[model samples]
Target: MIIVVDALNRHLFSDILAEMHALRARVFADRLGWEVTVKNGMEIDEFDALNPAHVICLDDDGDVVGCMRLLQTTGPHMLADVFYDILDGEPPLRSSRIWEATRFCVDTEKLKGRTTRNSISYVTSEVMIGAFEYARDAGVLDAVAVIDPVMNRVMQRSRNAPYDYLGTPKQMGKVKAMAALMDCSEERIAGIRDFAGINHDVFGSDDEVLSLFKENNGSAGNGSREITLESAYDFAPEPEAVRKPTRKDLREYCEAQVASAANDEEKVAALALKLELAEILRGDVQNRCDA
Candidate 1:
């Protein structure tokens, strides 16, 4: 199958939208038996229209068989809203530094076993790389994702293990983990591509690909894995006094912000402000620690 990654645009928007709804219906409504609101067989929400997302297309006999949506941290995202209940506190949002990847669905009926690829692991990887490039071009620094442990394994393989365990892998229905991309490396990107089984020619040389990871990593070791739930608690600014934000708080904060934003600029600006607040809070908490 020839996998193509493209930003959703007017020309292909309707088709991709239909494809996404169909995939969601198959996976969520039909197969999983979850009650998902479908409009003319399309599963969509406010986020679909609010965030910049990419679609994965499988051109097998000139048809789009599989796809997923990616949301950057700068936008309203599942990590900050729907899945916030699983988190310890408000996740860092509105960072030119980080992005959230969300709403990943594939047309399982159309393409099976794509996730098991020894090289790519799943079709999501391509969308991920596409998202990474999209972020990089837009000057994004980090990528944050709440992933299943199995999918986490794929991410670990991609970055050559740049992250440490944030918290023990928490199960949300399935075994899910909260993960961050503190840094990305060439070796990591190559590994991810190799794992995804994507042609190296498309990504370019080890050095070129590595350059992309480096660019994304930002400020040298700034990209290196450092802050984790374990380490954060251990060397926090106020180890004894600080308390992690609860999932409820995070969710309310996100929902409130989303509801309040009157326009895209407002939403982006608000999220950026929140990210700044999160950084300040985290830093203040960290400064109190000995380490």
Candidate 2:
């Protein structure tokens, strides 16, 4: 399940946010050996103070297994400040329609298992879909991410490849960083959904996410172990049926996406999706009118 944490609802997710920071510490500092600030088992930096929206993926036990940060490009951001070298002396692209996505990571140890719902690939696709959808609904057109070569390929394999890139790859610590641009559109989301076999909504409701966090907040973390996430989630014999959204829900969501579209391409994609939903919902409208 994906829960987006931002300034508006930060208070309700303090514990989950803390665990997310700790997970970052483990991935960026310990595993990758990045020169980041880690204190008391949590990795934090000045960028975290900017009130960016955090797209977090939780395991069945409610542990944060994957996460990424999103910040508007018109304000202070990593590519503009910390990673200025990647710009190749060019000024950072600043616009209200563009957002900077950073700090993407997943818990390899916790999610270590066969390729299933909780595998690294699945979680990565979930987080990517969640972040793009959330931003698209809020009027964002594009996302610029500072990613390494491995992540670039990961995005391609996951069917969420970047449409363009800004500046050349520059060596940063143990990896080379390049700024990749991805559009926020229905097509992008659909491709990822197809690749990951995720057809239902990826965002978890606030109540469900909070309840899960509350349940597992007190559980002590045991050292790494070889375990399959399918067993952890108690995989059912058959996949559960996805609950389809109501017609009203579909209309409102499509309207919001259409309203938020930033360019001609995005607007076209949103309208196409709206048309597709309209066809799917035509019978419901007729049935209601007859009744």
TM-score leader? 2
Give the distance in Å from residue 213's predicted Cα in candidate 1 to where it truly belongs. 31
Estimated TM-score for each candidate = 0.56, 0.75
lDDT of 2 at 152: 93
lDDT of 1: 0.51
lDDT of each: 0.51, 0.82
Backbone clashes (count) for model 1: 18
Q: Show the lowest summed lDDT stretch of 10 residues, model 2.
A: 233-242
Q: Model 1, residue 198: what's the lDDT?
A: 70
Winner by lDDT: 2
